[model samples]
Target: MLARTTDPIVAIATASGRGAVGIVRVSGARLAPLISVICGRSLKPREASYLPFRDAGGEAIDHGLAIHFPAPHSYTGEDVLELQAHGGPVVLQLLLARCLEAAVESDASTGQPRLPGLRVAQPGEFSQRAFLNGKIDLAQAEAIADLIDASTEAAARSAGRSLSGAFSQEIHTLRDALIHLRMLVEATLDFPEEEIDFLQKADAEGQLATLQAQLGAVQQRARQGALLREGIKVVIAGQPNAGKSSLLNALAGAELAIVSPIPGTTRDVVSQTIQIQGVPLHVVDTAGLRESTDLVEQIGVARAWGQIEGADAVLFLHDLTRSAGTDYAQADADILRLLSEKLPAGVPVLDLWSKQDAAPSTGPVTGMSLSAKTGFGIEALRQRLLEVAGWQAVPEGVYLARARHVQALSRVGEHLILAAEHLAARAQSLDLLAEELRLAQNALNEITGEFGADDLLGVIFSRFCIGK
Candidate 1:
C-alpha cells in the first residue's frame, strides 16, 4: 500500500499517437472513488467492465474497458484502475481530463476521507512506486529503461534477461561470497585476545585467494556485459583512397558512406549505427588521413584525427594493391607508427588489409582476404570485432548495463583487490578494510539506489517517460 499521506496519481501509460487503444493508469487510495465517479457505478476488484467514461459536463468521452486492482496487489502496490479507450490523441486527452475532474471526490465507499486528493503521475512515478513497495529492485528498474532504448535485438534480449534478474543474481552471488569472507574476518577480529594468528592462519589465506579469483571472474563477465550494453565506437583511419568507405559499407550492409574513387571524397566524418549479432557497432567513416593544401581537406584531416583519438576502436586500412607487396615494408612501418602516435592508447586497432581480392594469396601479415563486393571474410571480421570488445558467444543470461554500472563495478573490483593485498601482507588494517567494504557496498547500492533518499529518487525517476 502507498503511504497514507500521499495522494493517488494518474497518467496515460502508452506511447503517444493514434493507436487501436490507449490506457489511462491511476494508482493510490483515491482510485476507487475516481473510478466510481467516472463509471457511474461500483467496480469489482480485478474485473473488466464495459463502461462509458463521462466528463464533468455529463458527456461520454469514450466508451471503453475499465478494470480495478485493489491495494497491496496492484502494479504500484496500491488501489489501481485502468481505463482503456479509443487511441485517438484527442479522445485520450479528454479521458485523462475526466479522471482529473473526478479527483475532487476523494471519499471511500463509506464516505471516509482516505488519503489525499489525486495528483498527476510523473514520468517514472509508477515504476518508482513499484521499487519503493518491493515489487522490483533497482537493477530491474534500470533494465526497463535499457529494454526501451535497446538498439539491437541482442541488446533487447540481454535487457530482458536483466529485467528478469539475471544480472542481479550474478551480483548477489558475488556479494554473498564477499559477505561470507568479510564476516569470517570480522568474527576473528572480535576476539583479539585469542592466541590464534588470524592473518597467518592457512584457512584465512585460502579463503582470501578463492574470493579474489571469484571476484576476478565476475569482473571479466561484467566487462563483457558492459560492452554489449554500451557498445563500441569504431573509427576508420588511413591515407587517402585506402578503401575505408568500402569497409564501412561492407559492415553496415548499406551504402551509408558515399563511395568515390576520388581522394578526399569524405570531407567530414560519416557515422552509422549498425547491429552485428545483436551488438551495436557505431562505425565512423572519416576522410582519408593525409596533409592537404585545400582548406576543407585540412579541416577534414583534423577531424579524422580527432575521431581516431576518441574512438573505442580504430581500423587502419592498408590497401594491398596500392602497396604492390614489394613496397609494403615502408607502408607497414608508417601504418604502425601512425597507429601508435595518433590513436588513443588501449583502444583496439584492426590492421585491415583492403582490396584483398586483388592481393596475392600469400602475405607477410596475417591478413584476411576480404572482398567488400563479395562479402568474403565478413564473419571473421565480426568475430574479430567481438573478440576485441571482450564479448563472448555464450548465452548465459547476459544483461544490459550502463557506463555508471560499469564504473561502479570497476571501483568494487579495485577495492576487492586492495583488500586481498592488505590481508596477504598480514596488515591488521581493519579501518582500511572497512573503508573499502563501505565503498564497494556503495557502488552496488548505486545500481539499485538503495542507499540514497527521496531527493535522489526524484532525480532518477524524473528521467522516465509518463507511461513507465
Candidate 2:
C-alpha cells in the first residue's frame, strides 16, 4: 500500500445484472487518448456526452453517455472515465472488452500504446487507491465497504456516519490530547530538575483522568455500534413439542419452520435471522433435546448440543400444559443440568413457559410465559432478548464498528491504565510513563487506520466486491 500503482485499471463499475444502465470505469494517468479512441471523439471534462462506442476496427458496438473526470477531482484522484451503456450481461462484457483492447492499441502518429499497462481492477482496488492517493482516509475507505454490506437501517445509518468521518473525528480528538500530553512529558524528560514540579503544576494526572473519561464514553458507543454490525446468536433448546419452532416462527413473523403436533418432527437445525429494534438477532431453532431411538433424531440432538455450546444466549422452553407432571418436571431438570455443564461461562440462559393458552389453570409461572398461538408476551420477550444482547439505544447515533475496533480500544485502555500507574510514581518512572502514553497513542492510531500492519489491510480490502 505504500507504493502507488501507475498502471491504468478498468472494471464493470455497475453490479452484475441486466438493468437500464451499466457503467464501465477506467482510472489512470492521462486517459484522454483512450477516451477519444473509444468514444469516437474527445469528451468534455466533467460533463456527460452522448456518443457511440466503437471497436478498434471502427465498428459501432453500442451507444451510451460518457463522462470524463480529470485528475485530483475524481473518485480515485486519477483521470477517470465512466461509460454508461444499456445494462445487459453481453453489453457490459463487450464494453469492458473494448476498454481493455483500446488501452493497448497503438496510435498511428505516435506509434506507441495509448494507455500502457492497463488491466482489470482487483476487488476494492478503487477504494484502496482513493485511500493511498489522499482522497480519503483509511477509516472512510472502510466505511464505504461497511455501508455497502450493512444489513439493517441502523447499521446503514451508522456506516454513513463513519463514512462522513464521525468515528475518525473522535479518534483524532483522542490522538491530539495524547500528543499534547506527550509533549509535556518529553519536555520534562529533557530537564529532570523541573520534572516533578512541572507535571504537578500542569495537572498531568487531571489531564490523564479526563482523557480516560472520554475514552470510556467512546468505548461505550463503539461497543454498541459493533453490536449493531455483528449480532448475537440466540438458540432455542427444549424437549420435543415444547413449541420451540412455533416460538421461532412467531418471532420471525413467518412460518419458516414446519410445526407439527407429533414429537421428533424437526430432526435438524433451522435458523433464521430476526431484527429486534434495528439490531439483528440470529435466532436458531435446533432439534429438541431428548433421548430418541431414531438415528436421524440422535444426530439432530447431537447438533442441538453443538449449537447450544457455542450460543451467545439460550432460550430454555418448558411446556406449560405438562408443567404439573412429575416425569416432565424431572426430565426438564435433567436437561437443565446438561445445559449448564455444556455452556461456556457467562453465557445467558433464559427460561420461557410455552403453550400458556393450553395450560388448564393459567397459573403463575416461574419464567417468562408466552403463547405463540395467541401472540401473548412476545413484545416483552423481545425486550428481554435486547437486554441479553446488551443493546442500548443511542439517541445521538452510533458509528458502525467491527470487533477489531473494540479490541483496539481495550488495548488503549490497558496502556492508559499502565501509564497512570507509572505517573503516580513521579520522577522514578517518568520514562516508563512516557512509553506507555506513546503506546496508547499508537493503539488509537490503529482504530482510525492511521498506521497498521499491511497484512491486516490486505485481509480487510480483499473482502470488498470488484469494481468498488
Candidate 3:
C-alpha cells in the first residue's frame, strides 16, 4: 500500500487502567469536527490548549489538555487530535466514550465526508499507517514497538537508536554494495562472450568478497542486538549441596532462594532476571541433580535436567568440599560429564565452584571460585556473562530484535556464502545469485516490515495492548 486515507481511527492511546493522565487519540479528515463537538471549541492545530471534557448532556467529565495536529504532518500522516484527561479508570472510559460519540455525530453531518465512527484501531495500526505514509520505515515502526516493550534501559536505548534510523543506515549501506555487484553481474550477462572473463576478473571477485565481509559484520552486530532484546536463559544445575541456591541468591543480590548447608534444601527451580552490562540473564536455579531414593528429590532432578536442555547457558555448579575424596564426588563428576553431553553445541558451560566461604581456594578444577557470602569473583562472572551473551559495553547504538531478525540475517549470510561460491567457480549462476540476493533482501525487509504481509502485520500488532 502506498498511502492510506484518513479514516478517523480512534483509540485510547495511553495505557489502560489508572494513571496520572490518559489520552484519547482521534485521527482522520473528520478529526477537527469531532474535536469541536467533544470539546465545544475548535482546536488550534499543534497547540496544546486546556479544555473541559464533556458528556452528551454537556456535563463535565474532567478538564485536561487538547492538542491538534494537521494532516500530512501528524504521526499517521493525517489530521490528529489528542484529548488528555485525568487518568481515572471511569473518567478515561467516559472521556473515550465522548470522543467516539462526537466522531459518530460529526460523520453523519453534511460535507464532513462519511468516515468510520471512531473505529477501534488494531494493535500498531497507527504506527503501520505511519510506515505506509513514508513518515517512518518498517524498521522504525518495529522499533517503536520494541521501545515500548523493552525490559531494560539498554534495550530501550537500542530501540530508540533503531527508530532514529541507525540500524537502517547500516543495512542500506550493505544493500547498496549488493546492488552494485548485482548490476555488474547483470551487465556481464548481457554479453555472453565476455561473461567468463568478467566473472574471473580480480576486481569482480574482490568486490563480492568485500560485500560478504560487510554483510558478515552487520550480521554479528545484529545478533548481539537480538541477544540484548530477547535475553538469554541460563540454568544452574549440579549435585545436591553444590551451592546452587547460593549462586542464585548471590546473583540476585537478595534472598530470592533459600540457601542452606543441608543437602536437598531446594526442591524446585528458582528463577530471576539479572542484567549484566545491559543484557538480561534469565537465571534458573534448579534442584541439584543426583541419585536419590526420595520421590521428591528425583522429581527435582528431572526438572533440573529439563531446564538444562532448554537453557542458552548452563552453570554447572560443583561443591569442591563435597568432592574431596568422597564416593559422592565420583558420582558428581559423572553427572557433570553427562550434563555436558546434553548441552547443544555453541551453548556456553561455566563451572561454578561454590561455598567459597568454607573452601575459598579449592575447586573441582580451574572453574571460577564464587562465594555466596563474600561476593567474590561476582564482577568477573558478570563480565563472563556479557562475553558469553556477546554484549558490548561500548555505547555504539544498539536495537532490540527478535528471533525472526536473527533467522533472516542467518539466511542472508548463507546467501552471501552461496553467491561467493558461485562467483569463485566462474559458473553461470547469475540466476541463483539473483534469487539469493532477492531472498536476502526480503529477509532484511521483514526486519522493518518493508515487504510485510498483511497477516504478518496483524499477528505482530495483535500482541500490543488494547487501546494502544
Best-fitting candidate, scored by lDDT: 2
> What C-alpha lDDT, on a 0 to 100 scale, does residue 166 get in candidate 3?
84
1 versus 2: better TM-score goes to: 2
Candidate 1, residues 1-468, lDDT tens digits: the string is 123326678889989999999999988874656676788888988999998998876678889999999888888888888999989989888887777776764455666533346667877888888888887877788788778877777778878988998877777776776666666667656767886676556476677677667656666666666777778998988878878888899998999888888988999999988776777778999987766799999999888888888888887777777766555547556767877987667887877777767765745265555767677777788888878777775566567777767777888878877876766655467657756666666776776666656766676677788967
Instruction: Give the C-alpha lDDT of model 1.
Output: 0.77
- Measured against the true structure, the TM-scores of the candidates, in listed sequence, are 0.88, 0.96, 0.92
Model 3, span 366-456: residue lDDT tens: 7788777788877788788778787766557556666777787788788888887777655467777766767767777777676778767
lDDT-wise, the better of 1 and 3 is: 3
Compared with the true structure, what per-residue lDDT tens digits does model 2 show for residues 1-468?
322367899999888999999999999998988988998888888999998999878987889999999999999999999999999989989999999988888976688899998999888888878877888877788889989989999999999998998998998998999988888888889887753677788899999999999999889889999999999999999999999999999999999999999988888999999999889999999898889889999999999999999999999999998888999989999999998899999999999999988884765457799999999989999999999999999946689888898899999999999999999998899899999999999999887678888877777777788888
- Among all windows of 10 consecutive residues in model 1, the one with the lowest summed lDDT is 106-115
Clashes of 2: 0
lDDT (C-alpha) at residue 323 in model 3? 61
Q: What is the lDDT of residue 464 in candidate 1?
A: 80
Q: What's the distance in Å from true for residue 121, model 3?
A: 2.0
